[model samples]
Target: MKRLASVVALAVVVLFGTMAARALRIATPAATTGTAIAIPAIDTAAAALHLAAAVRFPTVSLASGGPIDTAAFLGLHQYLQAAFPRVHAALTREVVAGLSLVYTWKGSDSTLAPVVLMGHVDVVPIPEPNLRDWEHAPFSGDTAGGYVWGRGAIDDKSTVIAVLEAVEGLLRAGHTPKRTIYLTFGHDEEVGGRYGARVSSTSSWREGSSRHSSSTKGGSWGHA
Candidate 1:
């Protein structure tokens, strides 16, 4: 009788396990083939120059919530407008919280959800004591050995410039996207996104705009 009871328990466990495996198989999604996209040709030297120039702006954000650098932020904005004329002419730009920038490139299809690309302009302040350890000045925006070096270059300024560059190139190529795109550049992200990203997000929410995809800066990059 004991042997029979053990066999019954084992049979019940196997039955449930088989059912769970079949359910898992049904829940798994099938892999689909993706279409390959043609890569566009870009002027690498011009892009590098733009990035180097961007690094020169000393848009520093302190953790203590200090007074904002109005000149630095404004200068950077002016530079961008000058650098990418096509983008300025094609997209609607708004200055949020007096510093953060929100640019909208309207699409043809209103039914499709919009896309948001985020990056910050402000960089953390370098400590006075750590000044001696630098190979290059933090705000020098130096381009040496085929690399753009400076604060904010990798953290976020790169993304900002890269997006603008792509947009400008696309505009030059007469390519209009089907889905709308938003380029959000926050000014006070190093401290916190309170006055920058939050305000922009709130405005979008109020306008009943839902994003289909969002991408941010400050991630790993491949190097040669």
Candidate 2:
């Protein structure tokens, strides 16, 4: 029985190792010495700074005729365009309703269906005034006590920045994906997705997804 258990454990390890080896290895951005630079000058502190500035936009996307502040949301879009010039210049961007920001990076092969990486830009509304029970004000986007505080920071901005970081870093590194990559950031979520990115509303976000052979793959918020 002891010998049998040892054999089983060894077999399991070998099988798992083989399977993992077959998995595709994602290439990281090339930087300085040709080493994988995950992000171009990945400024952890600066990323937080950018998030803080974005939080200040107050992009609250509510339901239709539901007090959705289009102005604030648009402002955020402008800021991103201004901040990431390389991203804007390099990738082909499609904007729907001045809210949804969808960027498409043409892959080495257009034969493959596109993946829709989605998230929302508009955050939920904050109370008009403090309840006096909270320790930090929402939308502060502050790195307080080493914790990132904000409305969209955790919910989605993290993903947004991540995608941008990966792509931006990759671009700076001069790497490209074989399959198409589409980035979709919706405008509304808290209230409803009536205007949120459903992967069907925008043509670019879907990337001809309506086709029978073409399918869409995307990652959502809240994943490490």
lDDT winner among the candidates? Answer: 1
Query: What lDDT tens digits, residue by residue, belong to model 2 across residues 96-130?
Result: 76577778888787876666566667777766675
Cα lDDT of model 1 by residue, 173-211, tens digit: 887877688788888887877788665555542233556
lDDT of 1: 0.82
Estimate the TM-score of every prediction.
0.78, 0.71
Among all candidates shown, the one with the greatest TM-score: 1
Model 1 residue runs over 4 Å out of place are: 1-39, 201-209, 215-224
What range of 10 consecutive residues in model 1 has the weakest lDDT sum? 215-224
